[model samples]
Structure formats: structure tokens, C-alpha cells
Target: MDDYPVHQISEVVRHVGTSDRNFYDRYYFNCAPRFDGQGQSGVDGPFALIIGLGQYPNLGVADAFAVLRRGDDHLVVRASKALGEDRMDTSVGPFRLEVIEGLRRLRVVLEASPDNPDLSFDLTFTADSPAHLEARHFDRSLERVTFDTQRFVQSGTWSGSVTVEQVRTPVEDHQWSGNRDRSWGVRPVGEPEPPGRRADPAETERSCFFWIYAVLRFSEFVIITILQEDADGARIVEDAVRLWRDPERAPETLALPEHTLRFAPGGREVTHAELVFQRRDPSGGLADPLRVECTPAVACYIGVGTGYGLEQDWRHGMWQGPLTVQQLRRAVPEIAPWERMLCPVDNLVRCTLSEDGGIEEGEGLFECAVIGTYPRYGFHGLGDVAE
Candidate 1:
């Protein structure tokens, strides 16, 4: 990599700036068949797929996972490999990513795994709007840095094919839209560390009280908002913005964003939500607010077997030897008992933006997680249900 004159420092590309074992770079994407029904869940259409790839330079490991969910069938395929000096090669086993044209076009491929021949996809992503660089995410637990990362989000359309249960379906850009993000930095990955003065879950400092991240794509513009609040509803990490496809137009930063979420009966799964983004007055005072209503169209539990939160045996950056690939398929109802324990409840949310007696409709991804205690939502502790 040094021969290409792209070195950021004196060392080669393999030598990362940090020696922290948790330092990692990752790419994540999610896609679903475009919504065409009358607010239906799209269960009759193609399955929704989520793909993730991560490389831990210090840990010398690279891994990738692809998960597909449609109605009752849930399928996941994960692969891990020993990292080599060439970090440029972003392939692990049968999964690989191709940067067709950098930020403009990208492709993700997952060949059929012999162990689990039920799910595979080859999809190309074309950017619909310029990528939005999000605010830097930095958090700490006690004195140790837990998350220090930078990420960029983009909304796009996907074109290719997906095969599940040996049935291949074409993915047309006209009927499929997706969003992706690229982030890299120090974060928790792999196995848990030894119990050395571990923080208590009851402590507010150690728990994530409330969190919501959304990337909504409309025909003319895109909206991206992120919120992380403490148990008392104080803002910890927050960002709100509206982006456009025109390069001449700058990203609009929203102000004083608020959320009103309605959870399922006694559960934390968000059934409906209304996001209010206030405008800034000419003198920088508070102004009127713009409300966006969201409803879940299709839901995907991310932690099922994708090595995300606490759902399975494998995790990102974990060493699984030279090369390993595995797949899991389960009936959706069988996993319900433990599904609620997962961190995020990913949903394809249809959004309606209402302002000045007018409405514009669109759809995108809504990633949400609420645990510990969030008084704003009436959650009192870990595993507490919404009332």
C-alpha cells in the first residue's frame, strides 16, 4: 500500500495508528423490496437483507455476515478469516465488496455457501444522494474509551439478485432501496474482556438509556437523525439533518429534534413514532417544528445470528481460524422468546413528512434500541417493559 503514495503516516497501511485491540473498520448495509402495497409489511415480496463486514487490524481478523428475513424464515451466513497485510482485500470467504466507483456506486456479493445453500445475494448500490458525514461518535465508560468512531451515511437504490431457499429473485433499482454506512475507529468487538472491576449495570454511566437512528429517503431529499439520551432524557449524543441530491445545496442541520414513540403493548418495539425537528429563527431562536410520522412496514431482528448484540456465538473481529463459514436457518416464531433481548429492532419504516398542511411520503431504515432505564418512555430498568 505504501507504493501507492496514500500513506497517512510514516508507517505502512497495515500499521494502524492505535494499538488498541478494539480498533476496527466496518461497512454495513440494509435493503428491502420497495414498498408498493397499501401500508403492508411486504411479506409477499423479496426478503430483506442486512450485510456487514469488519476488519480489526490489531486483532488480525476480518469477518463478514449476511442475514435475510422474510415472514417466518430467518437465514444468516457468516464468515471469518485471518487478516493479512493487504487490508485492501475486503473479502472473507464467499462474501466480498467491490467499490465500483467509490461513493457513487458499490457492490456486495455473497456466494452460496456449501454448508448453508439457502441464502445468497449479488447487489449493486447506486447513490441517490451525497453521503452525509455524521457527527463524531465518542463515548466512555469510567476512564476507558468505549466508542470513538466516525461514520458516513448514504441512501441509495440496489440492483442485482437475491436467492433464498434456492429461489432466486431479481433486485430492480426501481423497486429496491437501501442505506449503507462506513465507520472505523476504536469500539468494543470480539469476546468480552476479563472481569476486572467491571461496571455495574445499575449505574447510569455504564448503561445506554435511550437511542434512535434513522435514515429516511424521499424522492427529492433525505433525512438523517440520531439521538442518544441518558436515563433522564438529557442529550448525550444527538444529530438531526436533511440532505439533498444537488451538490450545490448544503446539508440542512435541524434543531431541537424531539421524538414521540409508541411501543407495542408492553414491549419496547416501536410501532409508531413522530419526529419533530424545529427550525431556527432568523435570530437563532426557536421556531416552528416540522413533524415526520413513521410506521413500521417490515421488521428485522438484527441480533438473530449476525454477531451483533447478544444473539449468537460469533461476534465481529473474533478469530475463527484461517477461514470459516457457517449458516443458520430458524423459524421466526421459535426465536421470539429471546428476540426481545437483542439490542436493535431494525425496521423498514414508511415516513410521512407533514409541513404547512402538505405531506410527502417515503421510506427508509429505522434502527432503535432502548434498555436500562429511560424515564421518558417509562422504562425503569434492565428488561423493563413499556406500559
Candidate 2:
């Protein structure tokens, strides 16, 4: 098997991260079955499987989880362990994530345990497009700050098998499509205090956010977009990339130097979005525009299962070796309710995109978070008061 470069391993073990208490390194991926032979409407899949692993160096903890969503059925398996001295060992209990080749391929394995006999998988991901790095800067006020963040995204295919309830489903290379992202830096994690004690008066007055990120894969090419807006619907950051893959050569990125995005009226439950990308001519002149229309079909709260924000007992990276997997499963309700709820920070949305005079559809993740006070989204304090 291939191994990650030495420098990559060094970076993983580097203990001198920023001083922020929220600093973290994480791996995230989502996979869904490809659309059938029919047209755009034929692109319906039964489920989406999302897996994540996070390491909090400052806190000396690491965690991992897998969430499977099929219609109304959502199953989650999570595990956490102490950071220990060896950060290079990316394993928590039966969960292990390995990089086969830097920026090219990865292997993810989940072993079946008595506590979680219903889920397990051994999968490999091979990148089909070049990784796209994102700009990271969010400075609204002294109290609300986000900085020093770095992220890269790639669209790929999965090969292997997923065992659910002992029923194995083979994922052939090209039969399933997915996206994976690696991010490091300061962000909110762990549980929050009770609502009464967590109120911040200044946050509710002017704090709101809207974010959209999607990677749509077509037969010949892929389009990726990431956009963010503040409470008043003012643009904070935006960018889009068009990746074209040729059968005989490496994929190329078409420079979309200019782009614009418009979200539908309702800020909370965003169902529609319109995006236009403009490439510049060799002489730096504006060229014809390419437009994409999007509609969301399903969404999963980032805080649920993946553990962006949850109570201490249910949070990602929480120690889990004390209890058996089955005991942990039985204690889930004591930590939080199982019903679907909207969180302020992140959400993974499966959407359909229409472009290029043809309607090709795929699912991508989208996140909208308004951190301080924004009455429009019904956020009154630090928590998600909107729902």
C-alpha cells in the first residue's frame, strides 16, 4: 500500500498550533450512488453516507463518526479517544482513516463491533479533479472572529463495499461519486452552556450569515462553488471553479475570475439559488457568462452525528472507551433528541444543478450560520434559537 509523504505526517504531529481553544484538524467526506441511465431526473439515490474525523490538538482529543441517511432513516456511529503523543496514528477504536497518496487517494475503514453491528465499511477514494483551496478570513467584530483557516476540496469516486445490517453493498469505481474536504484552523466545537446562561445581547442585534457550497458532477466535467453572505445579505466571500476532465489527459480548471450569487428570499430554509460565472478573455475582458440554477433535495445538520456542536456526552472527540458500543448507543437519547433539527452553523445539502443548456444533477453540501443576533433567522443568542 502507498503511504503519505513524511512532511504530511510531520504536519499532523505538529503540536504548536495557534493559541485558540477551538483550533482543530478534520477530514470529511460524503458519498452517494450515481444516477441511473435515464436523464437528469434519473439521478435519484436511496441514501447519502457521510464520514468525518477530527483532531483537537489543544484539547488533546480526537474523534470520528459515520452517518447514513436513507429517506427518513438516519443512523450514526461515533467514537473518540485521547490525542496521546502520536498524532500520526489516525485511529479511534475501530475507526481508521489513512491517506494512500497525498491529494490523490485515501482509505477509510470502520470495523464492526458488538455495540454497532449494523454498520461498517472499507472504502477507497481516488480523486478525479484537482484540489481547490479556499480563501479564509471572517472578521465581523471583536466578539465574532474567524481566521487562520485553510481548506481544500476534491471530487472523487469510491471503490469498496459498505456493510449495513450485515448486507454488503459493493461500490464500484465510477458507480458512486463523492466529495471530500480537509480543513484546519479555529472553529466552534464541543457543547455549549445552557441557553439562559449563554445569552449575548450584542450578538442578536446584527449577527447573521448565509453560506452555500456545492460540487456538481456531470458526465464530462464538474462545477464547484462556495459563497458566503452576512446577516444583511451582503457578500462576505465568494468563488467558483469549473473543472473539465479530458479522457486522455489530466483535468484542467477553467478560470472563472468573476462570479455572482443570488439566494432566494427565505434565509433559513434555503431551497433555491442562482449563480453566474464569467471568464475573462486573454486581454482581461469579460466573456460570455455561464449560469447555474440549484434546488436542494435533502439536508443534514452538521451538529448531528458529525459533532460540530453538541453536548459533552455526544460531542465529537469525546472519550468512548469506557462504555461498550452498545451501551453508548443506548445512551444517545440522554444526550440529545433524535428528531431532525436545524443548527446555526453547518449543513450538508444534496442539490440538483441545471447548466450548459442541459440539466445534470448531483448533490453537494451547503452551510448557513449567523453567529450573533439576527431576528430574521430567529437567532437571539449563541445557540440556534431559530428552530
Candidate 3:
């Protein structure tokens, strides 16, 4: 693949900058149907799709997975293959991703396989808002660098068709929207190693991770906010920016945004949330705070079987064999056991937002993760459910 005229480094494209075995580059995408006032999809049934592809340079592995959620049923298709020098070949078995245009358009295809005719899709994503580069994610645990990565986000409209159980459904750009993230560098991938002596044994009990990432897109602009906190409720990472639909307009960064989340009874599922963004005046004085209210419509559990890792046998960059493909169909009722075991359950929620007193209705994604001990949420330790 480096033979193509796209080399930036003196070494081959496969030769990454780092020698770390966990060095990786990945692409993640998600799309959900927009519901009308009646809480129904434009078509027959509501559905959401989450797809990802990852490459581990040093590990010599590449993998991809596509998950389709329709109502209570989830269909997952995963594939893994040994990495070759041709990094351009992103296909694994029947799944492949195409970069139609560098940053403007892309396509993902999951061909119907006879081994599992459960789900397949051919979706094209077109960017509706300018790509926003997020803050670098750098975290160290036990004096070891656990996560160091850079990612860019883009919200877009999707158009294509999906087939599930021999039934085909059309996805229109006007009625469906999604967000994609391209992240590279190092993070936890492949298999887990044996745990050595703990740097601090007491740290396990106080461990907590809270993350809230939102990409709310309206006709005029898009609101992208991210908040991450540690066990003590101290901010680890924060980003709040508003991007306009027009390319020329500059982006606005909110100062010290605050969030208040309301979870369902006895569970960590967020029912709604309120985000307050304080704007700064040109004189460097604090201006009025902009408030946005979010109400969720549909939710998808993203960590179960699609390689995010939650009691799942398959994981990204893990060498299963030369080539492997698997499928799973899970009913929502049967997911409770896995849900309880997984900490910081990742959820992709389709939500409607209302800003200020005007009630400007806009639909987008509200992604939240809450795990372990957080005093602010009344969760003091692991296995402690919300009231």
C-alpha cells in the first residue's frame, strides 16, 4: 500500500511511529433513525447501526464489526483477519469501508453472508457539519500510560439500505443522521495481560470513570460536548464547542460547561440531562450561560458484542486465526445479565434537545458512560445502583 504516492513518513506506511505493541488506528461510526412527533420512525421500524474497523500495526491484526439494532433485537456481525502490508485493504471477510472523499464522504458495506443471513447494510455517510478535532485523550494509571490518542469527530446524514432477516429497509439521509470518529495512536487493544502487583491496592475500590459525549445537530449548527471525570468527580477531560453549518463561520468554545444528569430508578441509564455552557464576552468577562435540555428517544448498548468488550469472547486486534467471522442475535430481555456485569455501560442514545426558553427542537446523539464510584451521582462504589 505504501507503494501508492501517499507516503508522509520516510518509512513504509505500515511502519508506525511507535514500537508499542498496542499502537492502533481505528474508525468508528454510528447511525440511528430520526423519530417523528409520534415516536415512530419514518419507515416501518426504528433501527440503529454501529460499525467499526481497527488496525494494530505492531500486533499485525485488523478487524471490523457491524451491529444492527431493531427495537429489542440486536444483530451483530464481526470479522478479523491478519494484517498485511497493504493497509489500504480494510476489508475483512464480507465487510469493508470505502473513503469516498477524504473528509466529506464515506461508505460502509456488510455483505449478506450465507453463514449468517441475519443482517447486512450498504450505507453512505455525507458530512452535514464540518469536522471538529477533539482534545487529545491522555491518561495514565498506576504510573503507566494507559491511553494516549487523538480523535476527530464529524456529524453527518446517512443514506442507504439495510437487510435483516431477508427484510430490506431503506435509510434516507433526510430521516437519518449519525456521527463518526477517527482515532489513532495508542490505547488498550488485543488481549489483556496478567495483573502484576498493584501500585495501590486501595485504588481498585475508588476507581470510577464517567464520560459524556454529545453531538447535537440542528439545522443551523452542531453542538459537540465531552466531559470525563475520575472517581473523585474531578474533571479529566472537557470540551464544549459549537460548529456552524457554514464553513466560514468560526467555532465557539464554551467555558467550563456543567452537566446534571438524571438517571432511571435503580440503574445507570440516563433519562435526561441538562448542560450549561458559559460563554465569555470579548472583554474576557463571563456572559450568560446557555442551557440545553436533552431527552432520549432510542438507546443502543454499544459494549456488548461489537468488540467494546463486556464478557464478549471477541475483541479487536485479537488473533483468532487467519480469518474468522461470527454472528450473534440477542434479545433485549436477555441482556440484563451482561449489563450488570459491565461497568460504564456504553450507550448511544437518540435524543431531542431544547435550548434556552425558546424550545428549539433538534435531534442528535447523547452518549454517556458511568462506572464504579462517583459521589456526585450517589454511587459510592461498584455494584451500587442508583436510586
Candidate 4:
């Protein structure tokens, strides 16, 4: 084990993460076909496909899922398995996630299985921009530390194919563009509440905010923005926005990005936003602003399908013990019905941005989870309403 390559060694091998029950490491990405015409496509056709893999070290389990939204259909498949001591092995049944060339490139494979015969993918992602790390301090509470948290965002292109419902769609380099993020930290994972009991509002308040993260790729640059606001839409706990010009050539760096987000009537969804890029003068005065206008087209409610804190059967790392591939396959169908009924991708928005007076359109993945109150996204009765 000592002789193993640095990239091949997993964090679990070194016990590097915190002892928090919710500690998790995850990989998430969204891919879609390149827009052909000008402006935003407006969610008229096949939207996007999202894939994720998460490892909960303390709980001794790992899980993976894939969701494809084609036209009016939303198809999803999930699998989970016990995490063995060998962290180097990143395969969970038919799903296998591997780093082919460390941060620069990685591969994901989902072989055909009895439970999800119509869905499988063999895709490789090559990073187009250097990974940009987000600020770690998210919550206001100092005592309840979300420890050892690290996140890196990258804009990348996908190459390979994904089969959905017996249809194989090839994703050539530059033809299908997307962004990926790697996050590892103490987050809520696994079954937090007793089976069939509603989660307490106080417990849910830990993450009671609406988060919007959009990564837009253009001909010359890339724009990444992240915003997190509290339950009453008062405090902005996390605000990170940046631009990378010709990211393919230069090393990634952080810059001050000023922006305003305007949501729709209910304040649950973003309708329009204006991002201004500026630099401070030597004397601390603001410089001329470079402006961009963004209009949302489509989005996905991430929690709906991923099951972050929703259900016991869908929770990450809920797998109890060592299981065979066939047994895992058999378990998927039992949860498939629940996935369809409860999990809906409400906001996977395809967006259009006007930058430098040119209308450049692209597809982006966005999600909002309002835990305590009546969120405008129609998740009213899902959980107990906080007072």
C-alpha cells in the first residue's frame, strides 16, 4: 500500500476526514448537448443528464446515481453498497468511478444491469479549466463546524456515450460540455432520523437555504457563480463568483465579481441576473464594470432525485452490509417507484447569457432546497413546516 501511487490512494486509507457522522466525499457533474442556434434554447428538448457518486467513510457505505431528463421524461437509476476497508476500490456494483489522470481527467462507467438495463454510460471528462476552490466557511455557527470541507469546481467536456431507454447517444469532445465539482466534507448523509419519523425542524434548519450555482461556458471565457441565502432570504452566507478568461491556457485565480440576482415572484426561482466584473483601483475605488445579462431556461431540484436527506432507502451510505452485485441489482427496483413519484427535477435550467454584447447560450444545472418553510418550488407537504 505504501508503494501505491498518490492519486490511487483514497482518503479513507489515511483516515483523513473528520469523525463527524455526516462526513462525505462526492463527485457531481451535468452534461448536455451543445446549443445549435443563438440565444437560450428554453428547455424545449432533451435537457441534461446528471451523475453523482458519494462515499460516506464513517458509515462504511458508498452510493451512485444517474438521472437523465429527455423531453418530458425523467429517468433515474441508483445503487448502493457497503464500503469495504479497501478505499482504493471505487466501484459500487455496475457503477465505477476512476481517476484516469488525477484532476485533469477521470472516467465513469455504468455497466448494464438487470435493474437498469436501459441505462448505462462509459464517459470520460477532461478538465478545460483549472479547478477553482470555494470558500469553506458556510454556516454562521462556529461550534457546529462542517469540518475538513474542500470543494473544487471545473468546466469540462465529455467524451463517450450514455444509453437511455435503449437509445445510445454519443457525446463527442466539445460537442457536449459540462461542469463538475468534487466536494468532501462533513455534510448531512445517511439516515439521520428514525425510520418513518419526520425529521425535526431544528435538525433541518442546519441547511435551510436556497442555493444557486451556475457555471456558464462561452467561446472565450467561463463564468461561475454561487449564492446561498437563508430561510427568510435575508442573509447571504456564501457568495462566490469568478471568471476565467481562456481558462484552457491560464492557471485559475480568484477575482472580485459583483452581481445582483433577481428571482421570480415567489422568490423561490431566479428569473434574471446581472453579473458585473470589476477591479478595484490602487486607491480602493471601483473600476469600470464589464456586464453580463443572464436568463434562466431550465433547472433541476437536486434533492428530489439525489435523496440527500429525504428517505432512508434513498439515503447515501444506508447500505447495511456487504452485498453481491446481483443483490444490489435486485434492491434497485424496490426503490424505483418511490424515486419517480417523489423525486422531480424542478429546476435544471438551461440559460442564455449576453456577454460583451454577444448572446451566448448554454445549459446549466441549478437547484434550490428550502427546508424550514413553504418553499415556492411546491415542496410544501414533503416535510414538517417550521414555525
Candidate 5:
């Protein structure tokens, strides 16, 4: 398969295993071109990622990044040994280590090798350089490694509040029989409640309605890779950039258009962007999970920012989603005593930045204000936000 085009990777589900790490056996990278940096290298492929559950591939690939660079050609190394467990003869007095430049850097706190505890290497590279990273770079003499990204890769860093909001669509539920009468043919009925069609009595409900919300917020910057050309313009990348705060350093910014950046002969700012937050719901549960059809898909606006070029307001719930308490009780008439509270996201309370670093009033009232909030879970009644 060495003759296969690099693009063919996506066409086939290649299998890789982990000897040292514990998670993914195969990883996938969705490659795209962007003038977003130092023009296209035409040689270095974009930093595609582990296609699985996003744990190990990030680690192994990041680990492999330390050894390869833009100019190295046909470098065959062992991935299982560099990432996998102790298959190599470590008893031979500490394994050899090599440092390469124009590569990537990872912070190490304590050394691991039994023979060489103080092993340290300063892997320095440009802000974002094109480097070929694969686990096999560290140990070369072996073929077909037991490659698993989880076995060797460690999670990255995390900081800030920038986030991504996916649009939710309203799907149809087969549960909707549409008849106002009970499917059981109960003769006398007052208001029109949708017919219940549950095969088992336990599955039936009078009506099931819940709130779905999304918000936009700022987040920390983790990985920022950029390249400067001698006379050409600059290009900016979104996903390859890292977050310094989170353990995984996963790029909070999703994929965006490739941009051509200019350095003014030679210049770009050394940046550190801080994150702020807003909210609708952060728990990340689907608005509706039972339906089977092409539902609505729009960007969530609950936590968005103007600077980031995301001001999407999904079609549903744009105008007056959940209303006052009177409407809720009137809708079902099942629980009259339950009161609703609407506590606004008060900036005064949520934004008092003291040296102690805590919100004084953001933890405002749940019961005192009688605000316009209608909580659905755990707190069916009022006094849930704890004032």
C-alpha cells in the first residue's frame, strides 16, 4: 500500500494498535489545504487528528511530533517502543534519546526511564511549523508495531472559556399519533391531548416537553502554530491551534476557512487571548433523541461572541421558548404549587474579579427575585438555585 495516494487514507479504515498506550488502534486525519500559514509547504500535510474518541491519537501523534521535521525524508522508526510498553530491552541501561528541531515541544515534569531519571530535552520549534509526526519515529528497526494512540499519548492542557455550539434540529417522533382523543377510545374528554400509543403502560405519559438551549462563551488559547515566509503572506489555522489551559489542549476553535496572513516583511503579535462565558445549557444533552428524521440544524447562540464570527441563532426557540409560570401550570394543571424563577445572568454578580477569584453576586437568587426561569429537572418547584 506504499504506492497508494495519501488521500486514500480516508477511503480505507486503516487499523493500528497500541503496545505502550491504551486506547485507539487506528486513527484518522481529515486533511485540507490552507494558505493560513507560510503559504502551503506543498510537502508537509496538515495536522490531521486521531479519528476515534479523541483521547489517545492526540497524545501519540503529539509525542511523535517531537522526532520528525520538515526536511527529514523516509524516516522509519518504531512507534510501539516510543509509545507502547516495555517491549524493548530497557535493562540495557536506559534507552537512547534524540532531539530534533523545527518539530514540536511537550512539557515534562519528571523523568520516567529507570536508568536515566533526569532525562530532559528542550524540543524547540517555531510557533507553528510543519513537522511529520508518527509514533514510529522513536524506535526504527521494527515493522508493524502494536500501535495504539492511548498507550503512549497523554492528554493536553486546558484554559479559557471559548466554546463550540452545534445547531439542533426538531425531528419527528413516531409517538405523535395526532388524534386529540386517547388511543384507548375513552368516550369523554375535555382538552385535546395527543393520543398515547405506548405498547407498555409504563412507557406512556400525558405529554413530554423539555427545554433545549445553547450559549456561546470565550475559552483559553492552547496551541497556536504559525509560520512566517521571507516575502509571502501569512495564513491562520483554527483547529491546529492549542489551548494552554486544558489537559488535552484540544483546539476549542472548530475548522474554519483557510486564511492568508501577512507579516509586514516580518511581524505578528505574540498573543494570549482570555476567555469569557455566557450560558443557556452546558450539560450537552440532545434536545430530542427519540425522533428519526432530518431535524433542524442551526448554530447554538447561548454562548457566542461577535469577534469569533459566530452569531448563529437556531430556527427553533428563537422567539419566546419558555414563558411565565402561569403558562406552565395552565398547560398541564398538574402542579399548581410549583413556582418558576427567572434569574438573569447578572454581570455585576458574575463578574467581580477579586484577588480571591470568586463571584459575589452571580450566585444570585433563585427564590427571591421570582425571575423568569423554569427549571425542569431536580427542582420541579422554586427555591432550587439556592438564592
Candidate 6:
């Protein structure tokens, strides 16, 4: 469907993880474009999807291109999650065995196969002639059974999978270690307090906030963040991190100042370095103000003389997808109300990312767009009238 409105993806959410550790949630906010690089031509396509998660550090998706012959009316998708682990991950392939004559469904199956077959498929509507407007229904039953077998299999990491599609020419970034910042940077100053203790302070609340540190990695590619408050509040931050050689780099072999930040899951980064403060106020009041107090007040890359930097590419953005609102409403009636909520997840929201791991049709900031799909959603990112 051309410029079909955004489908309000509603899902029963489930969270699993330790209390202190980073947590994640599953929401329908993930969305991709409807029609992709299928040439510049398009009629109304189908409601498609490429889902994703927020702050999910480890999950990734892989797919393959296959054309089923006219003989076998069915296909199976099965695969392993971590290759050598007991945890077999699978997805609910997005199609089912249909009896209709001449129907095509391209599935971006999920990874909950064998055990829980739950994923989505993009079905293009076709008929003997152009006059057939009859709609298709979303099949919960087909969603029930997984091929329990046929999965688009590939090797290597997330970036590798992109190469399989032969659609990406990655740009990487690198940096040196010899010029490491001996000081790892500091936090903002705390609130002022009295040197002496006074009398009648009433009921007070103690608040404790985490100085959250995020390390995002896809296989061998990683991005680290150690956030602190804007001490001077001038919209600038300076960062200095001490660097040291673990194996003691040979001045002859290893490049001077070249620091390696493994992007793989267990790759290491300095985590949980922080300072805590306790305030004893006579007046019963709130807890101490919690703000990142960075010594320099900003985050920056102080490239030493080596002039080296980390690998390049933000490694963010989505792939293309197709989905018509009218088609979706016909497919799954549960989303009837969502038809009214057809808008970006955020008001100033500029883009939408799908979970199936593709860049669905949507837009945001002027530069805000899926790398190539250039999804042609209505101008506002959704609706009947193009934005």
C-alpha cells in the first residue's frame, strides 16, 4: 500500500533481566517501510515491518533471499541463535499456507522458531486481473506453526549479515592509544551545604540516581557513553579518559596510542566509575540533586599526536519496508483503534525503526531517513495527505 498510515503496533510486553542491570521492553514502536528497492515503480504495496528494540544491547537479525517455486506451497524457517548455545532462538515467520491462487508473501521471520514461531511476513496482493480489490486477513493460525526448519541462514556478525544483502558499503572509524588521557574525566560539583549541623529539620526523602553508562555493540562494533551533567550548563562537555596498555604495546609492532575497543558482546570498556554524595540538611527536604558533574563539562575525542580515532559510521538507521494502513486493518482487526493513532512514536519524532530489523517506510529530521529506502511515507510520516 502506498503511503499507508503508520500501524499502531501493540504487543503484550514482557521484560526479563536483573534489577540493576540494563533492562529492555518490547513495544510496537518498531516500524519499517512498505516497498523497498523493488525498482522505482510501485502500486500500493502491503503492510510490512522491520521491528527493533530500545536500548537492546545484544539482539540482532539475519535474513536471506529465496524464491520458492510453484510446486511446494509451504516453506520452513529454522536457525540457531548463538551458534553453540543451548538457547535456541527463533521467530514466527510472517506467512502461512494459503489456498488462494497466485499469492506472494515475503516473510522477515522472527527468531523464536522451533519453540515459539512468532514473526511477520510481507504479502503482496495479486490477482488474475487488476480489478480484484478483495483484502487479505492476518492469520493467527499460520503464525501458530513454524517451518521448525527452513530459516534464512548466514554466518558472521550483524555487519556481516548486511554484507550478505550486498546493499551496504560500511565506513569504519579507528583511534590510537599512546595518547591516552591519564585522567578518565570527572563529574560535576555537588550542591552546597553548611559546615555545621543545625536544629529542626523535618521529614525528608533521599533520592539516589544511577550515573548510567551505556555500551552499545553489534558483534565486533561498539559505542560507549559515560554521561555527566553540564556543569557550567553552557551546552559543552570536555572528556579525558586515562589510557594504559594491557599487554604493553611494543613501540615497534603496535601503532602508538592505538586503543582497541572490541565491539563484540563481552568486549571490555570502563564501566561503573562514579562518585556518591550524602546530604544532611536540618530542614526536612528532598534528596541531594543528582546531576552528572563532568570535570571538563563536555564529551570529546582528544586525539593525541597519533591523530587516530575510533572506527567510523554511526551504525544506526533502518532498512526499507511496505505496509498499507487499509491492508493492515483488514489483516488484523485488533489494531482498529490504532488506525486513529497513526503518527510517529514521538511528536518531534522524525523516524521509525522496526524490530524485524529493517528500515520501514518513515521519516523524521531532514537527514532523518532509512539509509536508502527513502521510504515515501506521507510528509508528516503518516496519514492520508502526504507531509
lDDT of candidate 2 over 274-303, digit per residue (tens): 666776666978666666655555545555
Model 4 lDDT on a 0 to 1 scale: 0.63
Off by over 4 Å in 1: 38-46, 199-206, 281-285
Q: What is the lDDT of residue 117 in candidate 4?
A: 84
Residue clash pairs of candidate 3: none
Q: Write model 5 residue lDDT over 83-157, tens digit each, in one string.
A: 323222111112122222212332111122332222212211111222212112111112323221211121221
Per-residue lDDT of 172-280 in model 1, one digit per residue for the tens? 8888888999999998898778645565444543355477899988878999998888777888778899998888898889987899999887678899999999988
| Model 4 lDDT tens row, 1-387 | 445665433553546435777778889888776666752233346567788888888888888887666665556677778887776688888989899897789899989888778778999999877687777735533356544466888888889998766778777886777889999877657876442322555545443545556676766566676655555455454444544546456533324554565544432345666665664555977655555566655444344445565455567667645643322222222334334233333444455555445676545554434433434444444343223
How far residue 78's Cα lies from its native spot in candidate 2, in Å, is 0.6
How far is 125's C-alpha from truth in model 1 (Å)?
0.3
Model 2 pairs whose backbones collide: 115-326, 203-372, 203-373, 204-373, 209-370
* Candidate 1 lDDT trough over 10 residues, lowest sum: 38-47
Highest TM-score: which candidate?
1
For model 5, the superposed segments whose C-alpha errors exceed 4 Å read: 1-69, 79-121, 124-387
Candidate 3, residues 153-251: lDDT per residue as tens digits? 999989998888888888999888889999998887888755675435586788877888888877789999988899877887888999999999999
Candidate numbers, best TM-score first, in rank order: 1, 3, 2, 4, 6, 5
C-alpha lDDT score of every prediction, in listed order: 0.84, 0.64, 0.81, 0.63, 0.19, 0.18
Better of 3 and 5 by lDDT: 3
Better of 4 and 5 by TM-score: 4
Candidate 3 Cα outliers beyond 4 Å, as residue runs: 1-10, 44-46, 337-357
Estimate TM-scores for all models: 0.95, 0.77, 0.94, 0.77, 0.16, 0.19
